[model samples]
Target: MATTDSDTTTTDDTVLSMENVTAGYGNTTVLHDVNVAIEDGQIACLIGPNGSGKSTLMKSIYGFADVKAGSVHFRGQEITGRSPQANLKNGISYVLQDASVFPNTSVHENTLMGGYVFEDDEKAAQRAEVLYDEFPILGDIRQQDAGTLSGGQRRLLELARALMVDPDVMLLDEPSIGLEPRFIDDVFERIEQLNDLGTTILLVEQNAEKGLSVADRGFVLASGEIKFTGTGTELLNDEQVGRLYLGG
Candidate 1:
């Protein structure tokens, strides 16, 4: 069973940790003194009501939002204020909440874009082929324009593209949002498969029950602060968490 801790101290197995992090867009703080840590190889989910700063927390780690205070660490290195490109090169990848596909571009071309940091085009193509093998559906529609893909297909493509770096940690913001009910299950399944393949994922999900069900560690964020932290099963059964966040 996975151990649970409410504190923010980094452990020997912690791969990503945010300590007293205050972050937000310019002149507007969305997260406040938030502390959380993701253990290596675990799927950690953050679930909260709207405007609770879940996405801001993600951005704080990836260098999208300005972190006004505190620090972020990856694999024991203090990487506070690192550039997004530097983070990606150091084995972290982020998938934003918005649609990020290049609509006019072919699916394969979009996948290739993920490897933009690679020095050689041939290396990028080689990496894309490995991803295509993992995501065969993308390989089948490699020549198709990304604009034509269904919601599920598009989500898969986004996931495939992000995998081009073979990242050690993946920050996913609202991955299940906008997907059909049928597609949601498929996406969650794919998330689990990725975890099984050794990717540590930090997910911000709107579907509280679904997110917690697959999470190894779960956090409840409210009003830009962490309200609760526990093993997923513990939070799922907590009466207060259910009544307030999970819609009892």
Candidate 2:
């Protein structure tokens, strides 16, 4: 699917939506009345500075963090504050920032872990091999322990593991974090490829410029609220966004 002209204006097919969600930690409020929509097979990027509640919002959607109010609907089903297991069952895969894979586990083991929702080992191994094909590097490193892989490789491994579940929407938290410049481009390119293949990606990125550049739509979140929303091109050309995020 092609990208839309406006960020806030979603395409005809919307896959996931957050309606007036207000969530936070135990006592501190982070997201306030946040709203965003992702169309089927489109890459939707969320950009903001640190502490802007980007990851917090994602965590709330996945039931990792407490959702104080509002609802997150995926494929038109209410999923707000649903258990992590339930979310995974609903085909929503979340790739956390802190490398959720077991450091001591082998790449194949981490990939197989995504099969928590699947009971059959044969089916799990088959899905893992498919993902390994998608991420060729994982194919050769399948026997290697995840801890020994480089930063970029581990991040790619995370994505492969996420795919093992065949999710409808993949929640990626700061995918480009700790990646070198070349690997960053590769990562975003693969994101586009995934979107092309009918995956809805909700990506949180610190490098707003690169994020929006490859995204179909972009949302600028500041202090937990959406300040600006537009097409990737619109956000790229905006003088303020350029001045702040694009190194103007």
Candidate 3:
């Protein structure tokens, strides 16, 4: 069966979008002629096999990957090839795949580092205090070394740190990796809660079911190309998708 872009309904109120985007590392193209648009205030998840360019797509949006062709737009402006700092300043935040916390640093210090771009230490400290109040575990062990925390706690610290900047769009890469089921649930809950609080989330997740369950929309990529795009429930009920991607 043949699939077409007309099968999916991409809206005009897109907060971020890519058109004919061909991006990758130097001289190596991973994504090919990709088009994806995410609406404002939506949790969008990208799922695919390993090496299928899911991470590369996220990197392209965050300006970590080179755009060999096409354009990336944010808020109706062409922002292709923008610097990560510029993107962050424009309300885009990216959380990397690996553990991004300072291992030896205290959780409080780690959280505070998220506001490094800010010029005022006092304001940053105040923001940290507010986040600590919301996520009390970090507040309870404000002075504890980040390395001493469990995997779940470490992930939470990373998320708390990301919120310091109060970004509008957050790009998350493999947030559930190395986490147990319970921790994974906690992470997803936090993500949904953040979305409810008005943060638009675009994430690359290994757990397709969990990722799509929380997402308002879902995109499936194969061979660095978008294979399907639809509402999360629509994709969940898709026959071909379940047969191929979702262990049927």
Q: Can you tell me which runs of candidate 2 are displaced by over 4 Å? A: 1-12, 244-247
Candidate 1 achieves a global lDDT of 0.92
Candidate 2 residue pairs in backbone clash: 7-230, 7-231
* RMSD to native, candidate 1: 1.8
List the lowest-lDDT window of 10 residues for candidate 1: 1-10
lDDT of 3 by residue, 152-247 (tens): 999999899889999999999999999999999999999999999999999999999999999898889999899988888877888898888888
**What is the descending TM-score order?**
1, 3, 2
Question: How far off is residue 157 in model 1, in Å?
Answer: 0.3
Candidate 3 accuracy as TM-score: 0.96
Candidate 1, which segments miss by more than 4 Å at Cα? 1-6
Leading candidate by lDDT? 1
Displacement of residue 55 (Cα, Å) in model 3 is: 0.6
**Weakest ten-residue segment in model 3 by summed lDDT:** 1-10
Predicted candidate 2 versus true structure: per-residue lDDT over 140-213, tens digit per residue: 98999999998889888888888888988999999998889999988888888888888899999888888888
What's the lDDT of the predicted structure labeled candidate 2? Answer: 0.84
lDDT of 1 by residue, 173-195 (tens): 99999999999999999999999
Colliding pairs, model 1 = none
